[model samples]
Target: MDKQGANMTTNTRIYLRASTDQQNASRAEASLLEFANLHKLNVVHTFIENESGASLERPELFKLIAASKQGDILLCESTDRLTRLSNEAWDTLKQSINEKGIRLVMLDLPTSHINLSNAGDDVTTAIMKAINSMIIDIMAAMARKDYMQRRERAAQGMAKARAEGKLTGRKVNTVTNDKVIKLLKAGTHSWSEIVDLCGVSRAQVAKLAKVVKAEA
Candidate 1:
């Protein structure tokens, strides 16, 4: 049987993110829904976005936070999905969640899984909160480190290519550009929807929109 808190609400808000439009931000939706169902959590909303986790400018994430009330659970697939922000940004995000009285539950973190269950005695709950906070901080730091390392490696690769005189900038995908133009002309999809459906960045879509407008 699923445990329920007698005095608290199990309201949950799910946040899912992918670093680029090429990745499906809703990839974890089904699994997370299943998890919520298994725990008998009342899923209030699921916010999906293709935004870099390293940045704190994500609109969808903040929307989820704003919609949450005290005792609401902010569920995520993992800590990395929740944050790959710098220490300062991560601290700010944590402050916002803490201030909102939100309980963050990450599926990959076993320590956090207990959060879905009924609350224990006050002392036990406090100890778990401290432990979970420490582990989440460590994981967030590691995620940031990984992001920095990948960026450094990409820079090194670019530098090597420049030195070798093989640094031809990214080639335009005429096929994708044509598709984006068609979608923009259709005037049916939002910028974000086009980004997801066409697997192109917002900048690319905006550029295509300009071309379509000029032709019109």
Candidate 2:
């Protein structure tokens, strides 16, 4: 930590998220740890989850907020990692964070980096906070826009495929499917547990379970 911020006691909660189970939420864990170490920030906990950024249904995120107290730092790799939520959902999330007096810190946002160090005087702090908040809002909006555009493109592609009579559902990952079948046959793991272990959705597990039962 910088000597200027050494006098302050800053507790940080690191949050890591991946849009899908196939992606490794902890991919940035080492970098985040280095960042906390470099800033001498006390990391109270690290929450990792595989969930869509566009949704407010992330259990781990809410748990993180619940665990945090006033003046605590909620650190992440980027604003997009924290949210690609719709405007209304984003507002709700922002309200929750603000109400808890938690500081939002993203590694990609330079303006937010000041949060890791001493914020100087009250006026400076206020100004910095305002600027940081505005920038974060802008970034969050951009992230949402990008997410929307991607979804639109995907929809258009699917439509085009259907028009061409070439539309088919996504190909099954046979290896993963086979694994799911084996686990279902073993009958030891719960559906939720299998989803976590196989990195497949609960619906997929259920479908596989049906297939296993039919074969039996």
Candidate 3:
């Protein structure tokens, strides 16, 4: 559903997101609402999450992906925020959207809006899809390269700190972990639920929550 959409009449599921731990999430919504208003469409839902776009899996993004229907329009503030990962993952995501018959909207990429409505169903549209897909492929590659460069710089900084013997690696905070115990003993929450609530991944949560349960 990576359509450059046009004249969308259906109520769109406007997804606004910021892929950082500290960055503000509200900024994604302001202009998207204006676009929806201008197009005379209703925004049925908005999901915002403070997570990295490089994360191959995200809770809110998955929920939105699964919830999308034939006529659903998945709106995002920008394409890079949807995925700034490897092209393979991006391809899978796009394939999933196409199979589900969803539409994608990007304020930063207006041509994507037209791809949503009338493009894929015709020969001319098919040609346009290829060209646009190529552009997206190029963009995704650049994003991956930039991600690698950033990681390299961060690694160099950490290495220097380690050499200076002044840097310590992150430790799991005890007080923060204690809340995971509270969630499990007081209510019937799933392990995954505990992970989300604790803002830790399931793998780490499994190791910790199990110990807390055994002691209790």
Candidate 4:
């Protein structure tokens, strides 16, 4: 609604994600809302989810992307929150965003922030987009590296705990397992839909499928 730097007005979609359920996904919502207001960008959608950045199965993020159009902004708190995907996954996501012509603006990457201005000059806009794309690529790589390092460290710690006889894997959630089994046995919904319905992963659904078949 409000005109920003380039005399062009566009809506912004705010994406907030946390790697685990324990983390508060919407913790940065207020700050992002303030940022949008200060920049004169009208925020049309706010999608928040607890999802692993290493995977691209984020339903909410995809919904936000699909719902957006050219000239619309995709705002995130940081690159890590947006993605810690492997190179291939990151490339896929980047391609989709570019193909949709959505502008990605991350707070941690100030280089992208300036590109959102929509300068009204084709040449300047093109230059900025190219620069911002490179910056995004580098940031995504760093995020993925950090993700891998953290995972490695955690794995090492678990191994040490196991060696000391102090490690025990998390208990399966029987309630969720039961729900997944029921959904799988019904054979009505797709695996992805069942995952969402039962709040379980596809791997869990596969495991339950075996149990259901064996019992049938």
Q: Pick the candidate with the highest lDDT.
A: 2
Order candidates by lDDT, high to low: 2, 1, 4, 3
| TM-score of every prediction relative to native | 0.74, 0.74, 0.67, 0.73
Which regions of candidate 1 deviate over 4 angstroms?
1-8, 118-121, 169-216
Task: Provide the global lDDT of candidate 3 against the true structure.
Answer: 0.70
Q: What is the C-alpha lDDT of each candidate?
A: 0.84, 0.84, 0.70, 0.82
Q: Model 4: which residue pairs collide?
A: none
Error of 4 at 33 (Å): 0.7
Better of 2 and 3 by TM-score: 2
lDDT for each residue of candidate 3 in 1-216, tens digit (9 for 90 to 100): 333336544547777666554568778688988887886655767888876666555677777778777767788887766776777887887888788777777788766767556434687787766676677667767777776787789879978977898787676576757787677556678988888778877777666655443220
Which whole-number lDDT from 0 to 100 does residue 154 have in model 2? 81
Superposed by TM-score, candidate 4 places the C-alpha of residue 173 at a distance from the truth, in angstroms, of: 18
Q: What is the C-alpha RMSD, rounded to one decimal, of candidate 3?
A: 8.7
Error of 3 at 90 (Å): 2.0
| Overall local distance difference test of candidate 2 | 0.84
Per-candidate RMSD vs. true structure?
A: 9.2, 9.1, 8.7, 7.9
- Candidate 1, residues 1-216: lDDT per residue as tens digits? 223456546578889998776678899999999998888888867899877788776899999888887778999999999998899999999999999888889988989986776565598888988898999999999999998898799879978987898878787688988988888767789999999998999999998875554320
